[model samples]
Target: MLLQSPTQTVMSLEAPNPLSLHIIHLLMLIKPATSGGRFRVLRTAVSFFYMDPTLMSLRSLQLPSVNTGFGGSADTRTKDLPALQSALLQLTQAGILTDEDSNGNGLNIMPVTCVRAAMLIRCNTLLRGHSGVCLELVQALLLLLRKGMTPIVPLRGSISASGDLIPLSYLAGMLEGNPDIRVRTSTSFVLSADKALELAGSEPITLGPKEDLGLVNGTAPSATLGCLAVHEANKILLLAQGLVAMSCEALLGKAENYHPFISSVCPRPGQVECSATILHFLEGSSLVQSLKEEDKFKPVELNSASDNPIIDIKSGEVYSGANFISSSVANGMEKSRLALQMVGKLLFSLSSELINPTLNRGLPPNVVADDPSLSFTTKLIDISMAAYLSELGYLANPVTPHVQSAEMHNQSINSLALISGRYTLQAADVVAQMCVAHLFAVCQALDLRVIHMTYLKALRTKLVSKVLPFLNGFDDQVAEGIYERLHETIVKSWNASACFDLQERCKIPSKETIPVLRDHLEEHEMHFVSTRPLQRDLENLAYPTFTQTRSEFFVKPPTKQFLGRASLGLYCFVREELGVHFHQGLVEHPGRKTSGKVNGRKKRTIGSWVSIIFTALTNDQVWGHLVEALGSRTCQVRLV
Candidate 1:
């Protein structure tokens, strides 16, 4: 019995459309037992339910006759009941065996029947949600996931798939009054199917013989989960592409790495699309000449019949086939799991390049927040990523290849689609964690790169004015020839050492990088006008311009003009929109809030910022904005 009255039940069942889009017609068939009325018509609209009794009955059908052709009475068809008795049975999902499973679709039927029941203390128990609800829904509920505003339903959304599609058309099926599904020895879940309809002030929800073939007997459960995995994979793929572009900029890569012709030579659709997308993100980037990957998943439709001996009403024929086998979903999920591991491997390589000083170009070792010796900020994450990568690689092994027969071998060659789908979701999660770590390293390295370039620009300006003019005074009449050679040498040498010469380790300058720049100048070979003095002066000027005590440029991050257009947008969004400022190394470790105080907020760690971006991606807050931010930047070719 409902603790709340009918009106309260009605109000609770009315889920507001979050996006404010109209829900057109959702047709429901409700049949009454022990009456001439074959079935009742129930139409659920945007916010209310209305019922209209349709003028149809089982008595009108000519069983074993010429017209309807729903033959019966020849051999006690439909659970030993006469043809008409089977059609009019009140227990909607039973009284006639539709497939191998005589009573239910083998799902935990409580959630399906009790989807909108607004369970009010049945047997001193209430509807139980997953323990992780708070972790998952807190952000959406606090911000975007209003009553009717959700287009993405949580795992529980499958319960309402039959009558409502909420945001996605992925899972589509329904159930009627089935009391047998509610009968169980255990008290877990436990709800009557008719309880929800009782709230609508209508008769019990039950389906007649024709509508009771199968809804849940097929591949919907595993297929729906697979669809969700596919959706998440797309988000991960796109974010990975953006991360690749940002990493390339930080590493000062040649943009030519993702050129169209390189991808076109191979021309696999996935590889081609990925390469083109990276090229688009690296547009206008000076780095692989520059560098640098949404959602469309089509598996089995959840509404399709998955039952054997399907009755075709229009043709009046019963076809027994194996439509219930879920091989498509099984193999699809298996391959998706492997794909996730592959993406994780790519992230592993990129992240290692960012943190390792030798591979990260001029960035500090470990890409630390401050002094390389004192700070090991990214070392933990780097180690964690190795663990994550290993787990992901292990998960990539095929789940379908190890199928086992079940049900006394009557059900041989099992699909194991559900198990495969579950593993795919697990793989997606690992890759997502890997992506987060990589992004953190990329953002830090990008900042250091920008600052490195900015200081070089300032130091170069002082050198050209002071040193170049002084060199021209060496033999004034022939000065132009000498000046041209010296000037060429200065420009080339300055540009070459500009990034490499300014290591964060040599903050005092000249101890490490200056000597290296002197040798690097030997390659430019400006011997016509000596450059050793020129190199020394440039080294001396680098200190006051970037030291902790006396530096004009150290206080401010480098001007944004040094960033490529694609990378600049991503960098600004991370800093400005997410409110995750650059890490100040050891200084940020000790937070502002008192540790024991419950009311005050503690300082967020570097991991916290990465998690924030991870949350945005998981909740789908970034994709729509990303499409707008990166409009048509992808390479396009006319398909033949």
Candidate 2:
């Protein structure tokens, strides 16, 4: 007995099967059309109730000889009934759903990237509502995102002219519950076709007449990858601008190049926008000079758009165009790469000035505060920066020019947008590393200058605030006294002992003295006095520590890990040891509230903090240690 209510109904059949239950549920879910007459109502009802697996085979055998727009030779093949059933059956029998055979050239793409691409395509189609895809197909796509199902899809082999046929077939195959297709579960485990369907609580959807063609007939995958690349490149541009401002500050470069008037003269929108952004970041910065300097600034710009054949629902017209061409995106990424390269060169030049005594105002050669002979890391830093610049140069090559023709004369032209996007990501990561190196050098130079130049105390305070919580109370009088004692001792030893004359004297004698000198000077050589142990007061008084050689100071060579740890140590040392309030920002500014939350606290994006940190780390002496750690291999800056 079947029970029927005003708004709900229970089905009672001879045998209550899953297919019948699904059909009844779907029927209840379908709403009545307001304007479509009997034919429209009938069509809507048929679309909902006809999605039974049992009916699929029988329906395929009885497909009416109807000629649809789909260009297959047989009318049956072009019809929705047989086409959907045949496509599903073909996927179930075949292990892989790629375009090529055994000898065909194809590339395997990441399962996640493929799934994301399919999701984007499905969303676009649904938003337009012109594709003849049934409600069942839409539900399946929604289910895919809700359950986070990722299916393996091929990268290469799609000529992209007949849409993304080869790659999209895998997407269709996964929805059809083909056991051969692999799916990635939310837990990051790879599951067989059946298991994935079961876990998702989704049934295999029966593709309508033109659904399979609709799924495969678009340039969704390439567009998705290109879009993602564009997004990442945009972020890189933001970070790169910040780095440029920091480099300018570290190098004591003039800010007039980034002035509004300079950009107004040329009137290039991209250049004007970049100039404004850089100038905004440099606002209130004492390090940047206001004088009009030579033109040395380059701006970053990015452009992104979708390239897919769109359908008009009102006109019922399918407009096929070469919108899938990604040449514009590829060119934009190349331009971004070039902009990053320019920033790298700026960092390199600033680093050169920081390490060279002649260039860095009056700082020690190589910015080595402790021992010049022991830790000459200037060459190492230069080589690393140069290597990173070289890689950026190589990545800046235009990918649009590399397009090739393939796929049986049908796919006469292609776009390598995905490849270009991947390269752009790699370039951005390398730029981050280069910025980190430049920051370390800048911080070191500032620290050395602060000891002697009182005029730079305010700048030093701002730079130190990022890494250190409070500035350590460095006594100039005490430091000067120590410098005089060390000078007198060195002179006396040179006159009294013959061997002392052969030993090279310390460069730039100041209140700062090497820790080894406090004990006793023996014939121009430092000797530890066994009479008393090293005191904490004496150690704290030493403004900067100096060593004779790399081996004397560092027990082990610095690695990337060592550099990271060392940079972190500087941050910790300032907060814990100095007992000063450490503001991560170079200048004290009010925090701006952001939508993001971290650990239940409202997050804020601090631009000044970013600039301060970049400047401090690049200008800091810690890079000397990183340089020594890298040794001769510093020139090998390969992207991982």
Candidate 3:
């Protein structure tokens, strides 16, 4: 059950779930006196927290300490304690801590959502022998999380060689009621941690012996942040597949590109899943009738016990291990960050293709719905995309290789996992912006391509009809043959204008039986149908240019009609639900050109539309559609 708060009581918490049953079972079987007691308690508390926060008593969780002389300075009872506190310095190093005393009370803060998750791994080492002294810390942390107590701490600090000490200490300081350690409440009220805790309905925790160290003495900070980064990356990974399918439709790319046979020969699990997902999302695509790892990723990172001086309750013994090192997590986060950059590069490539009229197949220049000469649609977007990509590339630089020795060489070759996790999250946001930009361009391109096809059809009919008048007076003998020749000539010219190489190559039998397959196979039956008369008849003929008659054909496109089943849903959601209408040039602008308000609200820009979609992306509203399109609904694909 979820604990609403420490004093909120069990009656107010949510009902028990399966995970809660597991915790209950563990509590029954695992004695608090055994070597596995710490594991049991950690799993119980975390699982219970996940079930639904409930007001569970820490009294039942407290265990008798048999080995208090082994862990952190808490075991020494203030006898020659080492000065390892560096909250101020760590914040200063990150430029977020500016207080002379090093308290970053009023500075920018990162809301660490994964702190609760990290506590699952953090409390593992804490409960070994010092459970009673700091059992309330876990309770206090849960309160902070429920109340949305965001620690006003910088993202830097913590080599993570001996857990995420520097960062976790800030967290610990917040719980211990450090008056200078700041936190922002759920209501955006920034104040001291002690005050925030009071607002959260908890009091400052008093540190005893190793209890303070216990609060920060694990890889909780690094692993917690890593979990957040990895989870978000995984979500984006799925979202990317759906978007790539939309891009393919906009570009009229071949469906065989994502064919299972292609991935079967070179099977990598992640690649296979991605291909399958993209292919599935392309289902029922009218456009696609032509078109189309994470395993053990959690091995040592988020789940590892990063505590120092392990306590064995049953054996009454303590052993030291390098479990506090978080290199594995650090490495994954760095690679994940690098992967985000690669994703941004792909988005750049796709956006460039969509905007370049010459490269975007039959779509108009820049996918501009208005005069291509005047409307620079998506140009600034392209530049912004590049800026985001460059930033992503910079963030993707490996933080592991630049590790500086910390704690006077005691943490030499430290794992900068926290830094890596932070950058990974940053890269994810950059890639997300790239996705937003690409989605906007792709939607515009889709509408333009659909209209372009119709316009071409209408223009060819109109243009070919011009030569009709010349041959109209002729008898049925030559007129039929002459008009047929004119049709073929005009078709070739228009096709060549869109894509030059398609002029000669034979197209398969589509709805039109294509050009080549219309009269059986052109290759097999070579009937030389040339027309010097038809060309001469149209020599001085004046047909409407795309600029002249473009207005008639540029009506709002029925996007769902041409899209595949997956893309159709996305298009409908974007247009209807999100209200991010098609990017229609100047009318979309806010200037006096189209009056102030289109319909009462302020005039919308492309950025406004994109921002709406981006907000939905962050809120996972679009992800819900993606899962529905995939034909199955789970929470999400958890990477770790």
What TM-score number comes out for model 2? 0.55
The best-first sequence of candidates by lDDT reads: 3, 1, 2
Error of 2 at 72 (Å): 12
Top TM-score: which candidate number?
3
TM-score of every model? 0.64, 0.55, 0.75
Once superposed on the true structure, which residue ranges of model 1 sit more than 4 Å away at CA?
1-203, 207-213, 286-303, 464-540, 548-560, 591-602, 633-640
Residue-by-residue lDDT tens digits, candidate 3, 1-640: 2122111111011224323211122122112211111221223332111101012232222211112222232233212212222322233223246652244343334443544345444544343332222345655665565566656665566677777766676677777677777775656566887788788889876554335445666777777677667767877877777788999999888788888888899997767777777877777777755542036344344334456544443343335667778888888888788777877888899898888767776565667776655677798888899899899999999999988876546567778888888888889988988988888888888877776566555545654465444444456765566445545555444433442222121121011212322232243343434434444333323233444444544444566888875687778778778877666676768764657764344677778889998999877678667778888623333344
Q: Arrange candidates by TM-score, descending.
A: 3, 1, 2
Better of 2 and 3 by TM-score: 3
Instruction: Give the distance in Å from residue 19's predicted Cα in candidate 3 to where it truly belongs.
Output: 1.5
